[model samples]
Target: MKLVIVMLGLCCYSALASAGDNSKGKELFQTNCAACHGEHGEGKHGVAPRLAGDASRWSLKLFERAVLSGVDDNGRKLKLMMPHWQNGSFKGDNGNAPSKEEIAAIHQYLKHPR
Candidate 1:
């Protein structure tokens, strides 16, 4: 039981350690999502739609479905040219599975812009 607790604790720490912050997310967005989505998510990538101000209109459901499944709620295809990062995320020198908490963070960031 003690060993189990220790292992679980370590897992939690590792997750938090790799957990993405927005600065990291923005950087990731630039390199991975920006080409198609545009740097500020402003869209106009010829294939991609404008991303800025898009999330405010969407429920998290819409957002998640689009990100994970590569399809929008309206059943239109989206950014198929890009890789999926639904179950996880990658940034910088490391790749990791983003926890639900992390996804929520990214969602919130997108939903509200500066």
Candidate 2:
């Protein structure tokens, strides 16, 4: 019984780690990121960089750090306009920050562009 429970726990964790729903990701992206990144992530000229191709290359860790830390993988600060969602707010957007799992879904969506 203990072994079975352990196996089940491991399976659940693995599933979560690998899971990424593009549909849900689209919704989240539209609500949270579209304003700056553009409707299809093509980006706003000189405001935000295109994320479709660029973001897909980022590792999950790097993506998560950027979302939460407002810093690039190299630890350099992003543009001042980029908001840090780690503290559950994006530049005073009133605490509307996505959880890590949601960000994973967004990552998956970004990786597979239409």
RMSD of each: 7.4, 5.1
Model 2: runs farther than 4 Å from truth? 1-21, 89-97
Q: By lDDT, who's the top model here?
A: 2
Give per-residue CA lDDT, model 1, range 3-102, as digits (tens): 9999999999988866533664565456566677766777764667776688536787777667776777687876657456764465553666545554
What is the C-alpha lDDT profile of model 2 across 1-99, one tens digit per residue? Answer: 999999999999988766643687777777788899987787899789888888767999999999888888788999878877776753334567767
Our model 2 lands, by Cα RMSD against the true structure, at: 5.1
> For each candidate, what is the lDDT?
0.63, 0.79
After superposing candidate 1 on the true structure, give the runs of residues whose Cα lies further than 4 Å from its correct spot: 1-25
Q: Cα lDDT of model 2 overall?
A: 0.79
